[model samples]
Target: MRWINILLGLAVAGILGFYGIRELLADPVYFLELFLGGLVRGSIYALIALGYTMVYGIIQLINFAHGEIYMIGAMTALIVASVLGLWGWHSAVIAILAVVFAVVYSCAYGFTVEKIAYKPLRTAPRLSALISAIGMSLFLQNYVMLAQTPEFQPFESLIPDFAFWEPYAHIITSVELAIIITTVVVMILLGMLIKFTKIGKAMRATAQDKIMSSLVGINVNNVISTTFVVGSATAAIGGVLIACHVGQINFFIGFLAGLKAFIAAVLGGIGSVPGAVLGSLVLGISESFFTGYFWSEYEDVFAFTILVIILIFRPSGILGKHETQKV
Candidate 1:
């Protein structure tokens, strides 16, 4: 009965979506612009969603602090750029260094966060670990507030002002182009790394069964730490690109982005990488179209509404595999 309802709902959605796509494409210029915007945003969401999915897949923990890790990354970039600007550094140099510094600091933060906040709770009750994650999130947010001031910091754009076929609905900006390219490249490289590398094998093994991986002489703890590092690194890159695109940052910026990315992870199937990517793109495109056509203030409402529908119909997500437990 449930499957029937889901199939019916999906069919209706597909029909509506087909028409929507046609309407959007009727104006190729506008459609291209909106699509590029959504792709950029979705790329960022997918990067962050991978972290959520990976952490949950391995340990079944949400690591709510993940968003703050992204915040730290953006904050690091902002600081680095500001400092370089004061030194009269070239825009290119400033941009490159800012991204580098952001990634480094985020990696360090990620490693420390996992060790201090998550590692201790590995043997504790599930609820306890969850509470600890929330507590750490608050602690990181407040810590940044105190350290960096609770004001919005302006991020200088490193992307040169360049556009392609601007008369046709501002086809795409250089920043957006770079973001899309970088995201796709990184995802591909990551996929290849996971598929072929030794560390990747260990990660896969650990994800499958930590106890068994450890029994077979795999360093489970190292794999877990590496997972956090990789996730944080991707988030850091996203922070750099997003901040460059948006031109401002604040202590609280990560909260909403984190929430949306988590939603994307859940929507894509909590443990599937490809699912995360698909979910992020869907959520991003939907939000972009909604904001453009409907009132901007309610764009978020539309996104959440979609989430509700997906949860009601396909809680496992578009590509996520459902698991069955046997007693």
Candidate 2:
């Protein structure tokens, strides 16, 4: 099975490369545009997928409500920006404040959700926790809908264009460039945090063995809550960036975004951070090409098809380890 998967993966890669090179030669500009567009999309997905991957890595539980948290972040930012804009604040300042508020609110919500919906169920069956996550997702969705209108809200782009980059603006907008750069910086900082910080060390230990970590004097609860907080922060940034790019947002936006990010996480091996980013980029680029060359309406169909293929051939994900369980 492993050999078969390897062969199939190689074949798919070769086919894609052949077609990609041909398309690049045929229309370099169009191809580059699609590639950049996909990169922007993948950056947003990577932000949200980080949260999904982190939580799953530590607890082995899928937090469905995570999407709601992302929505809340965007919604919060929209509200903040609207209020500030009415006061005639500068767009850059408004953006910074809005993002700060979004991160704070989203982190609060993430931490609260863990305590309220997941912590008590930590020792319970995985199904119970999963169902709780779903319920929380629904609750947050309706809560926001009632609090804010169900109608789509306009989100002004906070990213300012650089005068020096005018020549290349047609290929990638300032907003898209900002999103990509921000995702990269965040990923780098996150890598450092996970690799060097005391809390990061604690998180790694807990993910490896919760009981042993606790026995070793690490505060397991704090580590779990911290993970939730950090994940929420990244998702919030993604929400804001995407809203800025799309120019409109509704209560339901996070659902599709979160679902796609989850698929990316699974694709890259859910528990691995690097894997999540790689998976998101691959998914984003492939989707871009599919929509550009084929039917755009079936993009979701294509995403799921990839998911199914990965599940069948590489369930551990591209970067995930194959673990063996002993009876």
Candidate 1 — which pairs collide? none
Stretches off by above 4 angstroms in model 2 are: none
Q: Measure candidate 1: CA RMSD.
A: 2.0
> Could you list the CA RMSD of all candidates, in the order they appear?
2.0, 1.0
Number of the top TM-score candidate: 2
Expressed as tens digits, the lDDT of each residue in 216-267 for candidate 2 is 9999999999999999999999999999999999999989999999999999
What local lDDT score does residue 218 receive in model 1, on the 0 to 100 scale?
Answer: 99
Ten contiguous residues minimizing lDDT sum, candidate 1: 161-170
Weakest 10 consecutive residues of candidate 2 by summed lDDT: 318-327
Judge candidate 2 against the unseen true structure and give its global Cα lDDT, from 0 to 1. 0.95
Candidate lDDT (C-alpha), each: 0.87, 0.95
- Residues 272-295, candidate 1: write the lDDT tens digits: 888888889888877887776668
**Measured by TM-score, how close is model 1 to the native structure?**
0.94
